[model samples]
Target chain A: MFATKLKTQLLLITILPLLLTIAVVSLFILFDVLDSIESEVIKRGDSITDQAAVMAEFPLYTGDVDALQEVADLLIKTHDLNYIRFVDVSGQLLLTENNGNDKGRLREFSSPVFSQAPDLDDFSAPAAVRAPLGSVDIGFTDNSAEAQRFSAYIKVLSIALVALALGLLLVYLFSRRLNEAISSLMTTAERLEQKDFTARVEENGSGELRNFQRTFNDVIASLEQNDAELQQKINAATASLNESVEQLSEKNQALAQQRQETIDLERSKAILEERERIMRDMHDGIGGQLVASLAMLEREQDSAVKENIHAMLTESLNDLRLIIHSLSMQNNVLASLLADFKYRTSRRLEPLDIELDWLVAPEADSLSIKPQTGLHLLRILQEAFTNILKHSGAGEIRFRAGQQQEDFLIEIEDNGEFHPDTEAMSRGLGIRNMKSRAEKLGGSLNIEKISSGGCRLILTFPATP
Target chain B: MTRLLAVFFLLLTVLSPVHAGSVHIVLSADSDSHLQAASDIKAELEQQDAPPPVTVRLLKPFQSFQPAADDLLVTVGEAATRYVSQSYSEHSQLYSYINHMALPEPQAKHWASVMLDQPLQTLLDSAVDIVEGRYHNKLVIAVSEENQSMRLQIDQLTIPDSVELEVLVIEAEAEPAKIIDQALFNAGALIALRDSRIWSGETAKWMLYQSYKYNVPVVGYSQSFLKAGALVSVYASLRDIAHTTAQQIIGWQNNQGRLTQEGILYPRLSIDYNKNIARALNIPLPESMTAGEQNNVRD
Candidate 1:
């Protein structure tokens, strides 16, 4: 609402005084002219009255009304007098004349009809003491003065109005140029707010306004130049940042590939370590025992003892074969390893004249286990089969493998019509060894007699464990 | 011939100094009238075939004068005349330019004065002539009480039968307006005297104003009064007095250091008319009076 305050202020500053000065000067001139007209009218009236008095002095003193009338008539006719009257010193009107042209206002002037003494040239001479024979009163009208005053007023007012109008026109023209300059600056300023630094005001107008426009344009130009330099710096920084990010990404990929190769090398080293451990255990346990048994066989005296030595030799050889078979398996599938173990055990049992029964569930055949768990399960099965072959006089041995929920279950049964003492079996090394192997496999082991009078051994472990 | 000529030049040069008697003229003031009278006297004395050595001097207060018995002393104006009369009684003194009423009586046989005032009868006759029979046969004379002798003199004069002279003796310190009003009442004309007590300062102005108020013409004693609204005035002009004084000095010098006229001698008189005042009063002036040698008509 107050946006155009400068324009309003500028117009007022220029026009108000112009209007006031014109009005004041015009009024002064009008009053002066009017006063001059009034003064002229009064002076003319006084002059005519004085002349009439001088002419009527003798006539009025002599009481000659005719002569007084002539003097009054001559004055009234020649001058612009409303009326003329000659009055004697006794206050009696002797003669009166009127031009009959009374209009507008009237101003009356009077002079005594003095019988003036003679003029004296002497400096010390006394002032003339004249008798007032009578008086002459003349009436003059101000109609002409009023007319002239009216004409002057019209002229003064017209001139004042014209001057005021001219002043307003000039002010408006000058202020328009100034406002245009200011508006242009404001518009450019708004553009600068929106960050359009290229915006600039036109250098228009004169004097200070023109200088202001030029200064604004110079500032905008400087800002535009600065913005261009800033944009260039930002672009250069962005490009440098993109290049750095791409190099970091390549370095991360190379580091990831090197980490993956190191992990594969660690896994191969662990598998080789497990194989060396298994070979060392075999060299120290079964290989040494075979050497001792050969020595004993060479020194045996009884034939039955010789047969025992031959049986021990055959079991060791069978254990060695089972170890070889387990080592040669491609994957750690429990069913494949268990099937190999059943074939090896059946051959050993057939030499001993015992029947072999093997049942492998399909779900149990796909179950995978760690290599160490497979070795523990095979060792436990070997211990149970040897016990069945040597201690339990069993004619047939049954083996079964299946899955129950998340667990894998394996059962081995022997039917030999022999009831082994529980306490004695618990104390036996083979039974203890079998139990120890089952515990290592993270499973449970149980030995019991079935209804058909055969011993049953059950092993249960988690399939993923 | 050379011897006779040398003897004659010697006798002429030696005798010229013996016959040259100096004349001293004393003035009352450095006033133009007094100076003019003194200069005229000196000039007239010098114009003689055997003129005396003349010197003019201004009279100082309380100053004494000692003149040779053969040397003549001329005093101009009232102060110088009075001063020389009292201080140098035995000297041959000629007093000029003093008012006739103000002149002192002669103390020696050769002492004389040229009076400034015109004869009273001459002033009255001029007043009569100015009225021109317009006023109702009445002429008023205004004088101060100090000058009762002047009023008596006017009473003793033989006035024209057509003119009735009325004398108004104004008292000293009295209101001049009342006196003038009384004097102008029913009078056709007023005659102003030379008495300063009656007609000087504001009293003089009141007299003129009352004279106009009554429509009465005033005949004054001096030219100044004539200019001051008087219809007519009769007096001795300064030139007339100066010429008479010069003639008297010449006569005294020629008559063996004694004045030709004795006592208070009146100078040649002059009459001046205010034509404008005469016309304003509706008094017609006779052509004979206007065309006279002594008449000076001021329009």
Candidate 2:
């Protein structure tokens, strides 16, 4: 299957009819001209016959063979005759003249010759009366007709071929221009298919093709404008959608933050209410026992047993005061609470033969402490000071408090004679009580023997606790 | 009163016969030949024993002229014949010098013709005289296809002495030379009838030439044949036409303008001979033939 392009097909459609019409018209013209020439030649042949017959009449009447021969020769020479003959009524040849050429077709005409002036008064009239003396037979050659036909054929064929070639050239030129225009339009259409709206074609050629090119360009322009407007609309819609999403995300985050804050506020309120209940329970139960024991012991003095009892009762009362102070401190500032504990501790240490070293950081002033956590830290501190007084036998005590990596560090040291391998010291109630208080506050208390013959106790916990 | 009325009616009847007895000749002549023939007919009519009071009306084309009732119309030539036959058919018309007569309706009885051409009998009789009783009874007459009616009339002739009439029919598209050659074969004498196709142009010369070749004589219808080597020619002269036409009128007049079977008659004719042709053929003339019978001779 051979493929035909639009241009070739259009050229074929235009050229075939033109060529066929030229061929048909040429054929018709050739045939008509040939027919007309043949008829005229035949008419010429008949005219020659008539002329020769008239000239031969007097010669035949008088039986003048020389005159008849002269007339025949003259006719053969004057016209394009192949042969001329004069035959009498008895089929006798009287005179004949021929050109000795018979290659082409022949046209023959025969006419009778008679005496026009027969003597009506003479009874002995000649025998050329009621019969033709002789008939002139003239033969004309058709070479001219043949030559004319050949010439006409050649002329017609030449004209037909020229016309056909000219028609094809015109068709080809027209089709080529048309195809170029169409190709441009097709290329534009392909570009438009690929979403490129800026494609255009030149408005070349004439008439409808030019109009089509202009129309296609206009359509592409309209499409480009529409595409730009559409892109703008899409960008606006995307921007609005992004803004809506961002606003929604921000609102969701704020709502979660507020919900978390509300939960923290509820938890803090519950913790404060629990701490007040614990303080009331402690004041009503253990606070009355401490005050009664002290009063009883003050009346029994002067004996060694009674003096020992009085000292123990005074220490128990101080210990109970310390617990109350740690539980009752309000403002929740660790540094201020530590300052009050230091005043009491320094007063107790003054009655002994030891000097207290206090080191508290200013960062502690902004640190907040829970009430239960404060009580646990105060118990651990008191146990350490009491042990220093009763068991350390050191001359001075050093206490330090500061923040260490998100935790509060407290250190207490004493200058005393110490032993590392004493099971009694590890199992002692005083040291165990300090360890229990440390565990309760989510902190660790460590005791180490100092190289300078004193013992060190360290406490560490988160500052917020 | 009845006897007196009868006598007055009888007188009127007798007076009407006297006026109606006068013969009226309505002459419609259109050509010089017809005018001459008309005068000849008039002169011949005046010589009658009882000539009628004649009325000569020379009519022109498309002109209407009514003839008196009971008058005889002398229509000369074809134009006169056409006018009187088409216009005044109720009157009795006697046509003369008409080369061809149109036949009237079989029921209509007023039309008759005196033919301008000699009758077939006259031509045949002249043909027999030229034969001089030689070659027994063979006579060949050639007629063209158009004049087959003349051949039919010739067939009705009462030929004498068991004469065999060989008719040579000339076809419309035949070669004249071939027909003439065929007509002259084995014939005592040839009669070339007056036919446009068989005796026109060079045909007359061809016929005479063929007759000379066959050593036969041809008796034709025109005196031109005598000069053209025919043995004899029999043709009706204008005087003969006038004399025959007058005779027909007299016959009709004697019978009170009533047309008769003799109304159609052949005109008298003159005979011409070519003496040189007869001598060349070596044919003998009849002893009773006189110089008076020889109207003209071309040596």
Candidate 3:
């Protein structure tokens, strides 16, 4: 009962005071009305007794019983008297008229019957001048007072009920509106639990309810701000992670390519070292023995078998030197290999009393060349040199290498006796080998007779092949 | 010479009495009773020689007359008294023979009355003397509306010791038996004042009979009341009223137009008792219970 709903509490708060006020006022009015009614009854009874005393004065004084009876009967009929009795001073009951039945409710009023006119100057003054010849007693009832009290009770109770009802109605309406406002706030809170920061409650109530709505909205706005900041942070972190992943992939790819390039470099270095070692062995052992043998054969002078053996040893050593030079120079630049070839051929030509010219462009020196292409170019160059040393017997040779439009250019020219059948010499194994080496280098080889030379050789390929 | 001067002063004193106004004696009728009382009053006033010359008028044949302010109008009997007091209320008048005249109807200061009833003092004295040897308890004084003045007059008088006076005031239209029954309660003797309303032929007989039935002796105002079964009677006759009226006129003349006392005045009292009635009640009458004036007391 004490912790009832808001509506019932409001109803009680509004109606209890109204009921209390009505009850207190009704009690006050009822008591006042009863007092007034009793006063009127007393005044009326006193007045009736006074009148009866006056009327019975003459009859009682003269001992007129019939006249007194008449007066008493007249009083009972006219006024609200229940009964009236005239008793003489001698205690004689001269006349009486008793009409009332309810003796318990009757109020008796008595007045003195004097023979002479009394002094009425003071109404409350004692009748000192005239003694009572007799006295008249009149009886009355309080029916009207009771009826008035009953009527007042009904009216007061009705007013109290009406006021209570009106007050309760007003309180109920106010509390209902308050409850609805709170319910709206409850729903908004539910939506907030679902992370719907856009949800809002209507801020329409009094006092605490209004404050609650404002606070709820404020909290939701704060949450929305926090949510937006958190979402931005998440997106930023994801983007940063993606960028980091992409950078890591790129770095991994670069690292793998570097590893492969290192492996290729190692392999190429090993092959180049092996080829150098072979080139050294050939130059120290086989090439020197062959040269000594060829010199011994020259000292034999005019022996047919010794001249044949010297020719065989020189050819075999040249071939073995050519193979070693190709292997050793496989990873070198075209210009560097060409310079090496020029030095080697120039040394050989000095012994043979031939002058060699080597020319290479500085711009062509930076041109990268693959190992296979360098090897192929070296073999081709060897073939050309061998042709110069064995067939042309040219005293001096000239070599040049530089950049053309998008390719490297190499040319070799030597002075030698020209033969009509030199073109037919391309069909020979040595010329064919030179042509094949140029093709393998993705270049063209051409042999032409120079005007002041024995023969001309040209080779062209891409600069960084 | 001193004796002769004294005689001369005495003769001058007798001849030099002051006189004022005419004295007119009006009688109700030429009946012996009224005429004799009228003549006696006239002679008494004339012997005093203190007022104007006296004149007598009998009202049996009804004469119309007017009186001056200082003229003395002496009325005898009830009819002549009411007529003169009513008609000539402004004149100095003396009224007698009337039992009760209602104070002259709005009252005149110049009018004085000599009642035929005895004064309360004389009646009480006579009652005390009569009931001296008897075993008495309480004295009852009763009156009707017509005799209301006697009640007032008796109330001012002191009653004898050893007697409780119960004053009963009766109305005019009362039942005599009922009034007598209330008045005679524990009464040793009853004093009944004369009133035409109560002492009428029928009610008077009824009251006397009721008093006798209650074994209470009654003192009445007139001899007729005595004859109606009352034990004693004390009253003033017309002649006595006339003599008292004359003395009042002389006193008024001496007092410069003011009566010696205000209101109506009564004559010297006389006592009369019915011996037969007293014997019937088994009560002895006093030796002084005579029929004529025994005391000159007047009020």
Candidate 4:
């Protein structure tokens, strides 16, 4: 943008004043020369006319036409006049001579011939007063003077044109140099914008342009040096940042390993706790019954006692099988654990002449629980069955398990005597054990005597623990 | 004897008229010369023992005049003489202040005139006096074709043995410079005659210019020429002509009212000199001519 603008500006600066001066000076010279030529022609015409008037006085006074004619002819031929006429004082033409050169512009000059008288007072001096005898009229052509003026005009014009051309050439050469210098600076500036600090301009031209070149080169050199220093600082900063990033990555990997180890240690500790809890339950429940059965066999050898001992051994094996089934279940499905409990309880109920009605909804069968939660739920159901078999003596029982809104519900209903001591039975060890196990499963258990001479036990828990 | 002689003379004187017929002086123009001649004539007639009653009258153009046949009519200038001679053909007339060339022909037996021009002998003598042995003793004169009578008069003059006279007759239409140039060639003096065709106005100026260019002194016929650059002038003065006219009128009265002179008369001549022109031309005047009362010398 700047280069194009400067080119036009430089051209105007150089050529405008030169053209104006040449035009004005040429016009002035031409006008002056033409005016001078015209004046000279008029002066020459006046001189010739004055001489003719003096020579004509004698002939005019004597009324000599031939003498007047001869004077007119000689003057016309010698001075290149178009025509000459001698007129008397009354304006009558006495004699006239012409050369037939009356083709172009003409200027006429006239002078009066005066009658001379001798001065009586001063013998050597002519008289001061005179009377006009006649006049001589001369017609001078402007052809020669016009030709000279035209030649002068051409010469001045030619000189002006040649001078203007030379001036234009010099202006073009100088402006071109200036444009080149400015263009170099512009190119270098554009490179500087693109972060190419190595770009520089050549120091050329004169005066202000030369100074501008040097200043621009100095600025570019400073920028290049600064850019190099900044690049070095940036490289140092990048190296330091990379080292910090590497250290951070290593620290993050170590933290991740430590976290995984801690997680495994927590899981192992939890599993060991669960195993100890299972061993304590078996020792407390099945081991105590087995020891009592053995003691009774040792004391009495009756047939009924032997049969009771065999039943006790079978019950302890069933409890062991239920615990193993709950522990082996996948994802701790509460329905599978519940089904295993029912199978064992139903067989026990068949021997006791009791009917068991089991109903499990599809959603209840697909319900998932934690392994510990499933084990707690299975223990809760077993406790309920044991109480029914030993105390309530119900002939039939119904069990139902399904989802209710955002919670799960399990119902166990038995047709049994409505004992007036139901509140006392809820305080029994089996019922307390079921309640404790239900609390551990994140659920609740309730046993109540129904109005229909049977009892219902309900367990409800949230769907997601 | 004294008583007898005195009675006889007294009887002769008693028969003579105490005054002649009245003298009438008529002027042609009211010019100074004509008026002066009339006054002189009246004065001269009054000086007589018994003078006539002179009545001076100016002649008007186209006016009638009938003079007494016996009266002596004294006409001044050429115009009054011509008019009186034509109108009163038989009247006794005496003409004064008239040139000889312009005088009227005498028709009456008693008419006479005192002419203005001097004789050729007198003009030549004045020219010789001005030349004074300079320029080879030669004299030059120019005359126009109209003045052939004057040219004949010049040819008839008795020129002196020591002098050579050259006469040039110019044509009426010819160039005067060529003729003047030829006349002033190595001449001692140039004699200028009073001819309107050859020597008047611009022609006269040219002649004077040529005369100066040739260094020849000019002898002119009038006082004006002397002032105009002539070395000497020979002409008749108006006072001399007036005095001459007074003499003729007295003579006519004395001769019984008839002019004593029968034909044209000549006045006494006067000469004038321009001392400056004489010094410039290196010519000397004769001592006698310079000392004369009529001689006039101007710077």
Candidate 5:
């Protein structure tokens, strides 16, 4: 029945138009149904109920007993209400339910509304509008106007259904064999969209529809097949962008750190270099003087003097040494770096016996890369090791660096916990600094959990080319 | 007394009829015009004072044998069985006139034949010629009486894009007789409503897209047709023409249970009928006749 030439094409044509039509129709019908139901149901309330209440109350207040009764009874009968009564000041039962205010509840405000209403006299004489008479309450039972709305809704639904069925049937027969072609094309197109580019629509239905489907399929297949190449390009572009962004972020952080360091220097505002020279002089040249002073205290047996000289002089020399090291020689090949790194790391991690393994690959020994690159690599490794020590509870870790194919590769693996929760990883300085260092050298890094258990940090850097 | 009067009149009628000469009026049995002629004569003669002794003879629509070296064109009644049976024996009778009847709308044919004392052929002839297409080598317009023949070709040459060749069946052979014209008109109307843009496009992709994404209704007579991409159709009716012809026989006879001198024309129901179609085609029939799917009408 749906035998279309280009099965997929005709199918798409039939389906899309039909679907668009149906969707539009359904939305239209739904809104239409809602509007009708709302208007009609509310209309039901506004028209009959509103009218009955307004009209019935009018005569009741006008002091015309007969007219009031007639109006009340009419409203009651027309709308099928239950009771209509009035009350007056008499405390007598004159006008009952059928009558007027002669027999009803007391007209006092304080009267118990829940109790049966008192009575009063029927309207008489000048018809004083029945005194601010008791209230008039009119109501309808539980059959709200929802029923009408529901029926209208049902009618709309059925009509839409039947119309849809008929429309489909017409296209089927009229198009006949063409539908088959359309269907086959559609199948092929679907497969193509799912990344099956090899799929081709059958060019077998009506010639034109078939050709249409086949051509479309061919185009889609090509587009799909080329997706891999496209992805490669996109990924390369993305990598470049990410590298730029990372460099920018690191520059910004460095600028901020420089500003903070300058601020700290201002606060500490001292010629620490001059102070270190003075301290060195004081230590080397005045050392004998301090020692002789301590000796005089001991010889005189002045414990107070001895303790004061010992504690004060001893603390001064240590501070002087710190100042000298910080201000003077920032570059010390063997002892300086090892001692600095050791002191810094040990000071940080000694409290927790976190293990640290440092391995230099063949390339580091060969020194093909600049010393700065080596230093940067060392910093990154240090940052990673610090992270492992601070966060990774793993009992063991391994760090290895190598060079292959004119590329430098570094691997850092930890055995304990692989990756910390992402929230924790995102918040810290450890990962950020490591990633920035890697990008600064035109290298990429992948941090992933190893299947064998734990996390691996793999960094590969391209050579100058 | 009433019984005796009836008996006496009946006896007198029998006795008087004993010597009356009989005129055997032979006609094409199922031919619409001849059927009309038969009914007209029957009504007229029935009103006459003692109708002349008469016997109306009826023959099949198609005849097989050659007419004794003197015959002219064969009527529809003579065209049938005659071709198959290969015999043409007992056909001579009173004067016969073969009327040049036009095709009528299906609705008109139905009401005229079933609910009214009118021939369907007259109705078919009255329908307007709308869109023209060749069907069975005859030009057919979307009409109410029947889906007359119309030819459609959707080869690669017709359109700019991939050509789609599809066959539209207004009335398939399944029903073969119950002619429901309104249904077919409905299908044709739907077809006419489609934008001309549907003719050309990459056929398969569009179709799959439409079916899955749009859930568009495919016009067809049955689920398969719909599955194959047909949206609607009339149920089995019009295709059963032979059965309908036989069924219409009851409507042809008079109160005396005798066939009318004029032949009767039966309405052909299509596989696609709808109520709006009757109005569109200007056929005066009750609206209840539209019980079918919505499918395209092809002659």
Candidate 6:
């Protein structure tokens, strides 16, 4: 990647010398100007010296050495001749200048300018030769005079350099700032991509950058708002799903109750079967013994003994059959199947002067067709009706049998003068027998007082007929 | 404030000898010392004798002798203009077209009308730095080392105003024969110089000064002026005349003594007793002047 950049650098280096050539040419021009000016000055000085030397030689050769020396002294003392001397044929100085400390120029002239006389071959000085002659050496130093000419040049260069440096520095700083901003933008964009819009770009100083920062912050704020709204929606959806789950759980509980009812029916049926076997055995064995005893008594021709034997056999048979029916030896039976059970119950109750109303709907026949269901139902009805004849005082008894959906509903309601909730009220064995029978048959029976005042029995069983 | 003004002027008097009250200063370069001395002497005549109203001109470093319009010449002809402007607001600083350097180019142009068209003295820095940043004059001190005898030694070297040798037959003036001989010799030298064409008429003028004038010196007659301490034929009588005839010395001395910067001022003397003619003449030392031994130019 850098090879091309390196090539560009090399190209720049190659071009730099050509650019510097312009500076060199400018310097050459300056040198030429100085040389020309100096030459002009020197030429003018030489001419003046020649003319002045001619005019001054008048006092030299009159043979008055004092005056000759005076002329020489005048020449030396004059402002121009800075260093001039009158050296005779024998090389004796007449006069010269004396600057005590600043001898730098005199020292150079002392080397060869004085001794390298123009007429080296002319060693002879004739008696009439002119004297007090001065030679001229000149140069120009007008730097202060020309100072204005250079001011603009120097100012231009100084200002240009300053401007360039300032411009370059500011540009470089600005570019660096821009690069940093771009880099930060990229980092923010990546974070934004990750949904971390909360991280904000901090802008520094004044400029468009601050605006960009504010805009970015606003964008993040909008995103946060959106995030909140989306979260609220999600929460609402979750609540709805939870409610659905609760409804399903409630339905499952109901289903479980039905299953349990079925299970109970099977268990109660097994218990009823065991009880029926026991009762049958008792009838066969115990009833035969009693009968035999009775027969024996008859053969002796003893009327008192025969009568006792016959009474014992009859009571034992009746108690054993009641035990068998109370065992609830039935399966999958409906409680409402005991439709004619009420007729039978009232018939038993009539000699006792007990009133019983046993009512069953036409639909109750469906429940009664199942003998297992009818058997348990008839037992409960018989017990309740017997209880009404034996215990309840001045009572009107009601037995209702119907089908409510798949359930057999049986209710035994009684209106009796005896207190319904009083512990002092006698509960006959027949009522207990009725309640036990209903429970063993996988059904429930409740005794409640009606608003009109009386006991009411509500019995419910699965209509599995 | 008044006293301060007095002190400022006093300092100015001390630093500058010729303070032309209303005239702007002009400095020009002159390579001819003799002519410059004559010119200076003439100018001082007016400066010293004139009253307070007289304005003096301050000629700058190494003034030229044969300037197209010498300061004194311009003064004599009244060719000088006074630049007494009421205000200097309009004048811009002077600028040279050559080497670039800043100058305190005050508005002397507007303040002072164009006085003369002569080249002014080189700018202050220009004049002072003309000698390759070195002293332009050689210090040739020739001291007479003997009490009765004129011994060969240089004590101090003084810059001369002008130097020449002029010869006249003061005693031989009545003798046409002697004058003719001298004139023929001088004239022959001129003709010979022209024939050779090597030395121009300028050289002929120098020859005339060397041969006849015993006062002014010949140009480049001898090269060993510094080494021999004093050149030959430089009369001892010259020293006495300088003492007696130096009427313009005060103004010149004052100018020389006044300085704006600190500098060591040594006595300016030029010849040594060792020169053959100086010893031959047996010149006496001034009562106030001290005699000394020769000093090395190297020193």
Tell me the interface RMSD of every candidate, in Å. Answer: 6.8, 7.6, 18.0, 8.5, 39.3, 13.4
Q: What is the TM-score of chain B alone in each candidate?
A: 0.86, 0.74, 0.74, 0.84, 0.23, 0.18
Supply DockQ values for each candidate.
0.05, 0.08, 0.02, 0.03, 0.00, 0.01
- Candidate 3 residue spans exceeding 4 A from truth: A1-465, B1-20, B29-31, B46-52, B58-63, B105-109, B132-134, B145-148, B171-173, B182-186, B250-262, B287-299
Model 1 chain A weakest 10-residue run by lDDT: A117-126
lDDT scores for all predictions? 0.74, 0.72, 0.71, 0.76, 0.44, 0.39
Residues B177-283, candidate 5, lDDT per residue (tens digit)? 11222233222222211111221122211332232222222222221222223333322232232233223232232213222322333323343332343343443
lDDT of 2 at B284: 68
Q: Comparing candidate 4 with candidate 5, which one achieves the higher lDDT?
A: 4
TM-score per prediction, in order, is 0.41, 0.42, 0.33, 0.39, 0.19, 0.32
Q: Any runs in candidate 5 off by more than 4 Å, and if so which?
A: A1-13, A16-31, A34-38, A49-58, A64-66, A82-137, A142-146, A171-178, A182-465, B1-299
- Candidate 4 chain A, poorest ten consecutive residues by summed lDDT: A118-127
> Could you give candidate 6's per-residue lDDT for residues A228-257 as a string of tens digits?
899899999999999989988888887888
lDDT-best of 2 and 4: 4
Question: Which candidate would rank higher by lDDT, 3 or 4?
Answer: 4
lDDT tens string, model 5, A109-184? 1111111111111100111222233344444442344565567568767776777788788767767777666567
Candidate topping TM-score: 2
Residue B263 in candidate 4 has what lDDT? 81
lDDT (Cα, tens digit) per residue for candidate 4, span A244-271: 9998998898898889888977885687
In the range A1-465, model 1's lDDT, one tens digit per residue, is 444666566667787788888888888988888888888887888788878876776567569788777787788778877888888899987777888887779899988767754432221233557767778888978877778888988888888888888888887887788878877887888899999998888877689878888888898889899999999999999999989998888888888877887786677567756765775677667767786777778788769878887778866766675665566434368877887777777777777788887889998667877667877788888888877877778888888888888888888888865476879877778778777888777778998888888889899888884
Q: After superposition, how far is residue B73 of candidate 6 from its true place, in Å?
A: 56
True contacts kept of each: 0.07, 0.17, 0.00, 0.05, 0.00, 0.00
RMSD of each: 18.2, 18.6, 22.8, 24.5, 46.3, 24.8
For candidate 3, what is the DockQ?
Answer: 0.02
- Report the number of the highest-DockQ candidate: 2
Best by lDDT: 4
